[model samples]
Target: MEKNQKPLLIILAFFSIYVIWGSTYLLNKIAVNELPPFMLAATRFTVAGILIFIIAMMMGKSIAISWRQLKNTIIAGFLFLSFGNGVVVWALRFVDSGFAALEVSAQPLIVLVLMRILQGKKIQLMSIVGVILGLIGIYLLVSQKQILSQENSILGMSMIFLCMLSWAYGSIFVGKADLPRNHFVNTGYQMLMAGIMLAISSLLFNETWSSPWVWSSPVQLSVLLLIVFGSIVAFTSFNYLLKVVSPEKVATSTYVNPIIALVLGWYFLEEEVTLQSIMAAVVLLTGVYFINTKRKFMVFTRFFRS
Candidate 1:
């Protein structure tokens, strides 16, 4: 069992990030029908953060951090949550959904370049191919709409670019920076800090809802799912993966999420999965496979050449 532990953990981490996080898009879509975006995110993360903090304490994980560490965590929270997620949330108001998906799909590529440039990490050729393939697959998967022809289209695209950069930088920073050794503790602090910032922003902009927040079944269920799956499980898994694997590899979850999201749509919503969608999924997964499985893939290459 011990021998199988590391691979098992890696699989679990990937599953958490790829599937659970992808599912949140549907949840958020359903949720935004009732709640305003920033407030929804604020509530989700705040609640999730508190719950994770409590859980960490129960597990004997120390919740303490130095002032400097707290500062670092807050910066990460801003980058990953406040800017990365918040900007995307804001842009969705102006950007076409397909265009937004295309821009967001560039995250792995952004991370790849950032990792190479900022951290001076070397990327493998296969990984580059995989990221490109993933991007092409994503472009095919979504509607082929002209992105920048509308009013404020440039602004929307710029915000999404910032979103990708902030998220990529945050992932890299967390791996290098000294934070809470406990994953849950670190994530809890980060989420709480980001949630607070987003909530403040929402109020500063005078964002309002038509009704007082009521706990209808769908709203309650969406919030619960976001807390459990998105914040607690997927975010912690992301942090853990950043520690264990290359940040580029960790960022491959960007590509995987859309694939899982499409599958969920097909399964739950009875959405059509066209032949193009299937081909895109294959190309995307193939790219991801080559990118992450470098060593084993090298062996396969050698065998084929022989």
Candidate 2:
């Protein structure tokens, strides 16, 4: 990579994680309305995993992994993808995409608490303030009578919160777990294992599986976008950016993504953007920004760099 070209690639990679990733909430919501969530997630990741392997082979990267690496990948895969992402997809059937995005924007707060509980890391003063603000924002967002009164909305919110816990712990786990050296290979193994697990979950739930040919055009397009851009391109860009930029810089995506998701959902999906939601977003993202101080930021870098 040339010096000048590196900068351009960096900008493009940031765009991928910020814009492309943010759009996934809407895509998943769109597809989940027509296709079963687990099946949709299963198909997307299964195809993406296979394509990643092919791309890796073409790039002269080996896909081979040791048994130990395989075991770790399965655990990471289940935690991060199968439950973390797939369950969120399921919840989207009940919650608006923008609302879901705002709720998930609290992930940094979750990670902070998890570190304290699991690793005995002391919470800093700034982070303590962040946590307080995050809790306030969450209460405001979830306490809306319209939201709470929606059928299955509470259940959906509860499940999404559980998924956040899974993702936060998965981050901590991956920071320490031994996995494949190549990030691409590691991601491929995780996605493949997660896809299989989601497939099994879909079967157990008795989800109806239909051929893509029969799916609505919007649903088909959404699935294709999720696989190609959401799963592969953005993920590749995320890893690329982590190598070239400060993880704090990469972590800015945490702040940008929900804003994009909220706007996109409101404009394209006609999802309501309530005043409370806007207020919650401001409070939540501000708290996340405070939580990303250098000392605390290292915790995120470890997981992302893994």
Q: RMSD for each model, in Å, please?
A: 5.0, 3.9
List candidate 2 segments past 4 Å from native.
Answer: 1-13, 237-252, 295-306
lDDT of each: 0.74, 0.85
TM-score of 1: 0.80
In candidate 1 the C-alpha lDDT for residue 56 amounts to 89
Model 2 C-alpha lDDT per residue in residues 1-306, reported as the tens digit of each score? 324335556677888988898999999999999999999999999999899999999999989899999999899889978999999999998899989888888888888888889889898898888888889889989999879999999999999999989977877777667888777888788889999999999999999999999999999999999999998888767655544554335556778788888998999999988898889888988888777665634554343332
Per-candidate TM-score against the hidden true structure = 0.80, 0.90
Clashing pairs in 2: none
Q: What is the C-alpha lDDT profile of model 1 across 1-306, one tens digit per residue?
A: 123337667778888987787777667656665677788778878888899999988998889999988999899999988878877767655654334543565577677778789878788888779778877766664432333445676786788888888998888898789888777899999999999998998898787744434657887887888889888999998887787666766776766676666666567656555676566667656766656656743442222121
Q: Number of clashes in every candidate structure? A: 0, 0
* Candidate 1 lDDT score at position 154: 72
User: Where does model 1 exceed 4 Å of error?
Assistant: 1-6, 93-103, 127-143, 146-158, 209-215, 266-293, 296-306
